[model samples]
Target: MLKNLEPYLEKTIFNSRWILAPFYLGLILGIVLLFIKFIQKTIMMFNTVFSASVSDVIVNILVLVDLSLVASLLLIIIFSGYEIFVSKIDTGDHVDRPSWMGKVDFSGLKLKVIGAIVAISAIDLLKSFMDIPNELSNGEADKLMWKVIIHMTFVVSGLLFAIMDKVVGDTKKH
Candidate 1:
C-alpha cells in the first residue's frame, strides 16, 4: 500500500501542471478582447481623421501601436509559458508555426517580457507628451513629469535585465 501510494502521488503531482492550462486559455480570451478593442479604435480613428487634431491623431496611432505590443506580449507569454511549464507544442513541421514558439527558454521569455514592457511604456509616454494641452497647468505639469520619470525607470530596468541575462548566459559557457 505504501509503494502504491508513492507512485500515485508522484503521478498526481506531475499531472497538476494541467491546472495551468485554464490560465493560458484565459490569456487567449484576453487577446480576443484586445483584438475587438483594436478594431473599434481603428474604426474610430478612420471616422474622426479629418476632424481630429494632429496631436490627437498621433496619440490614437500610438494607442494602436501600444496594443500591438501588448498583443505580442500575450503571444509570447502563452506560447513560452505553455511549452516551458507544461508541454512542448507539437506543430510537426507546419510551415506556419512560429519560429520561436517552442524555442524560447524561461530566461529568454523573461527578457522578452521586459523588452515588450519597455516598448509599451515608451509608447504611452509619447502619447502622454503629445496629449499635453497647450495651456499647461501646474497639476498637469506634475503629472507629465511623473510619466516621464516612470518611463525612464522602465527603460533602465529593461536594459539591466538584458545585461544580466547576457552575463549569465556567457558564464554558463565558461
Candidate 2:
C-alpha cells in the first residue's frame, strides 16, 4: 500500500508550481506601482517648471532621481527574484534582457539594493535638511538627527556589504 501511494505523493509535490503563482502576481502589482510613480513624477516636474522658486525645482529634480532609483530597484527584485526562485522571464528573440541582469548574482543584487536604499535615504535626508527653518524646535531637530543617523547607517551597511562581497570573490579566485 505504501509503494502504491508513493507515485501519487510525488505527483502532488511535482504539481506544486501553483504555489509560485502569487509571486508572479506580485510582480505585476510592482509594475503597476512603477507606472504610478512615473506618472506622479511627471506631474511633479510640470508643477516645478511652472513654479518660480529655484529650491522647489531642485527638490523636484531630487524627487525625480529618487523615483528612478526606486523603479530600478523594483525591476531588479521582480526580474531577479522571479528568475532565481520562480521561473525564467519569457523574453522573446526580439526583446533582450539587460546585460547587468545576467551579471548580478544574489550577493551582487543584495549589495546593489542596499546601495540604492542608501542613496535614496541620503536624498531624503538632504531634502529634510533643505526644508528646515532657521530655528527648528527641539523635537524637529531631534527627528532630523535621527533621520541623518539612519541614513548614515544604511550608507555604512551598504559599503560593508560591497567590501564583504569583494573579499569573498577574491578568496574564491585564489
Best by TM-score: 1
lDDT of 1 by residue, 1-174 (tens): 898799899999999999999999999999999999999999999999999999899999999999889998999999999999898899899999998887799889998998898889889888887877879999999998998898889889888988988888789664
Q: For residues 64-142, what per-residue lDDT tens digits would candidate 2 score against the true structure?
A: 7777778777778767766666566666543566866555678977987898898889888878877888999999999
TM-score of each: 0.91, 0.78
Off by over 4 Å in 2: 1-21, 44-49, 90-95, 172-174
What TM-score would candidate 2 get against the native? 0.78
Scored by lDDT, model 1 comes in at 0.91
Clashing pairs in 2: none
Segments of candidate 1 deviating more than 4 angstroms: 1-4, 172-174
